[model samples]
Target: MPDSQTLGNRTRGMGEIVDIAGKTTEIAPFGNTLAELGRERPEIVGLTADMGRYSDILPFRDAHPDRFFNVGMAEQNLVLIAAGLSKVGKIAYCTTYSVFVTRRAYDFIAIACAHSMANVKIFAGMPGLLNGYGATHQATEDLNMMRGIADLTIIDPCDATELKQVVRAVADIPGTVYVRNLRGKVPVELPADYKFELGKAKVLREGNGEIGMISTGYMSARGLDAARIVQSEGHDVGLLHVGTIKPFDKKGVIEFARRHKRLIIAENHKTTGGLASLVIEALYEAGVYMPVVKIGLADSFFECGSQEYLEKKYEVDLPRFVRAIREGV
Candidate 1:
């Protein structure tokens, strides 16, 4: 048997998977989608903890100046205001960094929104390692924290396309929703006609029954890239995009995993209590015995660097996923 710690160290320093490739594409799908929805839904109100620009909600703010509220750097107050708006029968769409929402304003989210069942939508930016702004900003455990809240829907979209679809879908839901928002040059990976439904997972590709890759948030894009490399090397690897993290689609996961002998859960968040945990729990409950591999951040704080550099350091980059899928780790 492989020493788990030694294997972990080897995997963490696997070096650059692929060169820092691809130009940064800036598309404000979140803000754009909100703006479009706001025009159609009058009850939609936008709130920000002075992160309107960073969270990509500027388009919504600009379009509905009267309906936008900047709550400054006070994240707790932001949730409070959102809760109040929800009480008044308005759909509150709050914006802030993932750390701010999970750390600073967790109470308001749990009590003000979740407890009261407010129609508040918290759109959080800088999800997991996407920020690379050090420990203070990287929300590697946001999903873990937010998922424990009862009556709160957790969503981690895969790309700009899914981001737009999720934004529109969450607005229609009645209770509290926590969304892992992607900002600044978000990539468009999903098909144009793809529709987003709450608590449903989508299977992107059906590979040979050798390996199945399950991914959430933007990590699905990375998983796809890794799957391509695995396929090129003559391995049969499939891809499943679990966009909705909480209220996890267990039926979808079980069905997808049934088609493969080994399964890998790839996510941008930490290994524990996130997508990997959900998959493991589902598998255990169903008495499935497939070997599972997890590709995500280890139990540690992050450093400041470019997104790609941080990803490689944590062994959650494209190359690490490729290595795990190819080697059956």
Candidate 2:
């Protein structure tokens, strides 16, 4: 019998996976990410907690009607059902709002799923402040919540391309996966042929003078934009895009930052348990010194608004990041 600690050991590191050129993809529903997974594998099943449509699980629900289940408003039941299905040798993709899944359904995932090492991928919608619904709906601390848990794979994709590759890769990895996917059309950041592999960081552009931006999620694009803005203004700032969170590529970051003395960690997550925190810890452990700045969510829950509104208000927008870089200079 396989140990519970490694029940989902079919795949290990994301860096081990072959580079997938998901760059040809366009901005659309996360359904495409799931649909691509569905078309490729028959063992894959999808579950949702009354948010199949909102979380973009509708495509899987429609494509695999027999394999998909909607547990309806019950986050606990959602994880329970997915776990049962997974124990029976099914690869389950479960979707729900981040708040409900993280806060309301924490135990079920922590025990019923992770404790057993089930092959379940928890696709969380409205991660962080992407959802402007209300306080009760905000999932500002979901990453921090999942990061502390053991035997769970955590992913926060930067854009559509990374989203597709990450969805597929985590689906293949064993054990419970907590993925935070924001709704709507994510801008295309990577080039049309860019490659995505988990835990493998990419340097979109590097600092020519002395500054760097290591960004996660859609904010990575803002980092690139900020890099360009700073470049035009006589500052050479490099852009490092992190497609996968949690088990990050520390070696890559340390190597890059060792070349630059100034660094900025940009992300859509709050200051705690986000990109900023990880970079700081990794650098400290490696004895890498650099002035680090975080351009991401403020230490507060988001109010109602669109993604643009939330980004600008939280100082993660491109303009704000560029301005912050100027201030740093």
Candidate 3:
């Protein structure tokens, strides 16, 4: 384990979150994938609440302009319109900020989409701590809120690879699906041959007798980095990427926990009522007991700052994981 002095200095010197000004990232995956899928499936339609460009659905708009609808800034109307389209046998894929989709359109999502079992896929951008515009923009509690909506399938893909596959997988499902999205310049984390399946967890790295690091969304990238650091320091750690949130992979989670003596569950959202709670609940039901640690936001709203700054301050990054593992917390 690293000493406190070493860990503290590393934490204090963490870099702020900022986009590269010049270098181009991969063409937004969701937009490009949707555009390609739209050519094959005419029933797939795109909609956004005036966030076509921000949410990266513009490619779909350009590809199938006739099937796209921009409903201005009314989020409720955004969801309601999607429900209407779904009712008419269209697979409606709506894009918006996760904050708006989960906060402003909660009722419409619960009633119109989930209650009615509408085939509406809400691809929400800036989920969890992705945004830095204070509490109003950062949707740190969306997974908790959306999970309570009965029968709603929730997904938080790790990267471009999983996001593209998730979009296609949920399109054929019969009910409402909530996808936490990465809008512009989405990173590619998995290998080219990685295949994504709904309601399954992927074991990205294998280690034993130390920490079982399970993560979701972009945080999985951080977890993988942390695992590498732990291994370099002569400790063993494993990483299980649980991209599916609502219908969590209970069997996979149990099997992973059984292999390791301790667990560190990392996520970008609040620890309460989210992935940590789901995993704990599953372990309890299965009579599996192991010391667990959570790396995520506290039960509080974040103030305005850059996404990188907020993540560092809240201690949800790779450095935080290393420190926690060293301190045995």
* Per-residue lDDT of candidate 1, residues 1-329 (tens digit): 10112223222221111222452344788899999999999999999999898888999999999999998999999999999999999999999888988999998899999999899999998788877568888889999999999999999988878888889998888799999998866767777787788899998888988889999988888787777776767987789999888789999999899889999999888999899999999989998888999999887898876665677788887778878987877
lDDT by candidate, in order shown: 0.84, 0.75, 0.84
- Candidate 3 — which residues are off by over 4 angstroms? 1-25
Tens digits of per-residue lDDT, candidate 2, 120-153, equal 9998887765666656777777877887778877
Residue 23 shift from truth in candidate 3, angstroms: 11
Mind sharing the TM-score for model 1? 0.92
The reply for model 1, stretches above 4 Å from the true place, is 1-26
**RMSD of candidates 1 onward, in order:** 6.0, 10.2, 4.8
Q: TM-score of predicted model 2?
A: 0.88
- Residue 329, model 2: lDDT of 28
- List model 3 lDDT by residue over 110-219, tens digit each: 99999999999999988877776788888889999999999899999988888999888988877999999887666667777878888899999898667788889988
TM-score of each: 0.92, 0.88, 0.92
